[model samples]
Target chain A: MIPIILFLAPALAMALFIFRSKKLNAVVICLYSFTHLACSVTLLVHPASYGRYFQVEPLNLFFLVVLSVVLAGISVYNADFTLKSAVPARKSTYYSAAVLVFSAAISGVVLGANLGMMWVCLETTTITGAYLIYYKTGKEPLEAAWKYMFICSIGIAFAFVGLIFLSLAFTGSQPSLFFTDINAHAPVFNKFWLKMSFVFMAIGFGTKAGLAPVHTWLPDAYSEAPSPVSALLSAALLNSELLIIIRILKIMKIADLGGFASAFLITMGVLSVFVAAVYIIRVGNYKRMLAYSSIENMGLITISAAIGGPAAFAAVLHIAAHAFSKASLFMTSGNILKRYYTREINGVTGLLKADPKAGWSWIAGFILLCGIPPSPIFLSEFIMIRTMFGRGMWWLAVPVMLLVTIVIYGMASTMFKMSFGNPQKGISQERFNILNYAGQFVFIAVLCLLGIYMPKAISDLITAAASLM
Target chain B: MTEVLIAIFGITMLYVSSTSRVEAYIRVLAVQGVILFLMVLLDHAHLEVLNLVFLGAETLLFKAIIIPVFLMFTVRKNNIQREAEPFMPSFYSVLITTAIFAFGFLIAFWASSNASNVRPLYFGVSIATIITGLFIIISRKKIITHVMGYIMIENGIFMLAMSVVGEMPMIVNLGVLLDLFAAIYLLGLFVTKINSTFDELHIDSLTNLRD
Candidate 1:
């Protein structure tokens, strides 16, 4: 009961409070984050206590931890992030509500046992996140928000259509759409409809997951959205969508649709890598570049999931690591935007010279994002490569390696270019931005520490979650 | 009997292709919407009363009345009325639509033998309508006309859903309604925004972000 309330309270409070006082959204988001983190910890310690509507399964428990930690970091940064905009009153009133709703919707998506319920939660994420995307109502943001809404709405609609088809596939003594029920009887379902449904589901949820071909909306959306929301979009929101795919992948295995589905996923996943590789090179906007990098990481995870076996474990671990590292990177980028007043790669230089705190965080973030050593992304990528080779798909591993290398050079060159050259004239020095700088450091430190030493508990949780999938 | 109405609905696309006036397109939407309402009523009369009521109210309120009325209001508000110029000549457009419509029927007919349980008439017409909507969206320059194109595609999807399943979870139905309504509202709002921001709502002007 408490866990259910923990999930519901944020959205409810956000709705009730935002109607009256918008500035309270940040405080409400913080309260929800703290309470959620506390509740998830409690639920983790006593698995029997979380009730039926909600449970902290080892898989979702790991996601819950990632979500809470990232939310806390975003909440702290938003405390100051929201103030920088001119409409302080509106910012305060609306920011927390948006965050709370987004947080609740994402948590619900991860924990949902029923597919219909998951779809509703995913839709809610879109409707609420649209407001955040359009925070300033600038032309570019509006364009991005429009694309996000229409594309996602269409994609989700296709997902629903797939669900209906999946229901049709369950032609047996008793048909059910519940995940548990489907898993129980997946062996006997019609192969054709199941294959068709998986295709639709993969593309539908994959669009939301920021997988390639259907990923045209990500760079526009993530780059234009306010920084904290981008963090949530890349970190928590993408994970929830991946959770749905993971669920479907499990079903495919049980149904013996494994080979076909894995081929499809690998094909799309590699296409995403290639697309991200091409686009990340010429992107002059730093924020857009980061958004494209997210596309690349998501593709890597998809391919890893296709490889399965121990690599599935690596995929889940990569999710956790990427969530932290990307959130930290985007937040630090926000700090840079504050000092430099530009997101253009060429506009601001000498970040170590101008603001060392943000500059070094930026560089370190690039290192982790590029899968360099000591970062958990590096560890996860290495394991995935090993999985590919062991599976005798040496050619597949080459593209994955090549794409990663290209993206690394792409991001490193951009960051190095932006962070080292002489400070361009007319850049303002921001003194009151100390807390934002502090928030970035704390987030980066968490990622770096986790990379250096994975605690026994977290590793246990990852292994357990991988087995369940 | 249902097949006849479905055919009329498909033929309306041909009529739509031959027209230069935006008013005629709206009229096509009005006719299409009513036809969809009737088709739903005929097909689902054997369903549970609660389901029938829900379906009836959805078609009557949203499809037939609300959406068309809303589009009409937006049309009136954006007054340079008739869309006289089209990218392709009307004769060629009609010929192309006819070919597409025939192709849609062929595919649906081919598929029906495989999926013998569902209504092929519904499948064929809906696919043709969806194609026509795409055709109009591509050929028309006016934003209002494009909105019309979107509605036609949405109507096709609705008809297809009804014909195949004949029943949907009420929650999904509600969601579908909410999404469509919100889409129109947002698109309408953007149309207004575009009109004021730039001198007109030409989509070509939104190309400022290109490489």
Candidate 2:
């Protein structure tokens, strides 16, 4: 029942947009967000009651919570942001509808019990998100939207091929697409087909996860999109894609092919970090830099998952922490963009003087993202490094740490320069509504609070989700 | 009979690689769709009425009719140039595609010798088609050509899926069909948008957002 409502609320909101009332659009979006959050909480509390097709397991519960929190925050921010933006009414309605649809698609991805259903939901996100990226109605945004749609479509098409290969692994059996059934039957499956399937799935979903080699579209799409949409792309969409990859890893584990899969993940993970380091150091666009940072963090998560055991637990924690921190950072970047009217790093200075709240939030979010003290990413990175050393892979740890340090320095230098300098003379100093800052505040508060204290229930949930992987 | 049809399907990709015209690409796609429809009919004699109907609609209507016609509509609407302007010359593309086809045959022969459960010819042609499609995408400069290449890839995947026809659930088939239609629809729409936004439909113009 909850799952049904969760799926329907966004559809209802999208339908409401046809009436073209901006006020109603805001009302419906907020209503949908609160309802979604409520459903996530209820589902988290009683995950077993859901139907088989959309069951809320511990792993999905954590993702659902993260998504719901981010959605709630974004919705609040969007209400204020949309009101002030110069977009026409019709486009705003479309934007509002697309946002709802995007959220619903992500929720569907998290809640989907079958791989096929998850794939469908994931593709839906690409479509809806393409619209959001194209919201600015410019040549560049159009290119971003086109590349995003076309490349992701190709990537996902390959993933579908991967799914076909996966089915081929079930030779002479009652073929099933359900995750539980696949896991149960994995050991007896054809190893060659399974390996082939994993390769395709990795490339296919890896494109969406913004893994290196297939991550060409990520920076462009992120930089070109509206900030809130960027937040959703980095925070929720990437996590959902990773969730599929994690499920594949679980199947690999059951088939005694965990080592093989882990090797590939680690290779891609290291490559992603290396790629992020290369680009982050010289990136001209701040949003593109944030996009690169996302790639780096995703790489770390992949590396953590590859290390398995305690590192897997850290991977889950890092996912949650990164979501909040990155969302806040992206939202704050929105504030910066609003004030400065430019995405170029060189264009803005004295952020602290121009807008103290956004400036501080930017610094805080960057620090949190950089894995400074108490940030869950710091703990996650520590555990991952320990795992590497424990496994006698100190060689791998050295480059990873080096690359991470480079990325940190690159991001921090730019951030500090932007945050503390004298304001550029001609830029207008318009005050933003408090509501615009509300989401970032919530995200930062959560990130900071979690860094210092982990409530027992949240810790238990993270542990349970990790153990599943 | 199915083998001959599959071979023809594989040969279509060669023609596609050698050609530089957008209309030729669409024609190739339509021909492949028809061949696929025939292959399905010949291979799945035991399929239920509903399944047969679904396959017929998928192959004949959507793939052969709707997609090509819709693409042609987009092409006409945009008044796109006739020449595709490949990154590489036609001769090289043809030579490379031939080499790929030979490689596919080699793979098929090897897998047949190894007693693999997969039908070697199906695996070989599908893999070659997929590779050729990717090559087309990479070598082509125009967005429409890229889309055509993507369709080729979809056709290859469909061929592979046909190899294990009854084993997969119906829902997977439905999902695949949905994805295909949606992807094609969206790609076509974007082509029009790109036409209007940029002076030309060349993909090089899309480099504005890069770092």
Q: What clash count goes with each model?
A: 5, 1
Instruction: Residues A284-397, candidate 1: write the lDDT tens digits.
Output: 899999899999999999998887998989899899889888988899888788778888888879988888888888998888777787788888999999998998999999
Best of the candidates, TM-score: 2
Worst 10 residues of 1 chain A by lDDT: A47-56
| lDDT (10s digit) by residue, model 1, range B38-103 | 876787754567777777787777767777787677767766457735798999999989988888
Taking the tens digit of each residue's C-alpha lDDT, what string does model 2 give over B93-202? 99999999889878767645643567988989998998899999999998888888888888888888888776764633754566676557676668777888899889
For candidate 1, the clash count comes to 5
Residue A328, candidate 2: Cα error in Å is 0.4
Clashing pairs in model 1? A22-A92, A22-A93, A23-A92, A23-A93, A25-A96
Q: Determine the TM-score of chain B of model 1.
A: 0.89
Cα lDDT tens digits for candidate 2, A256-311: 99999999999999999999999999999999999999999999999999889999
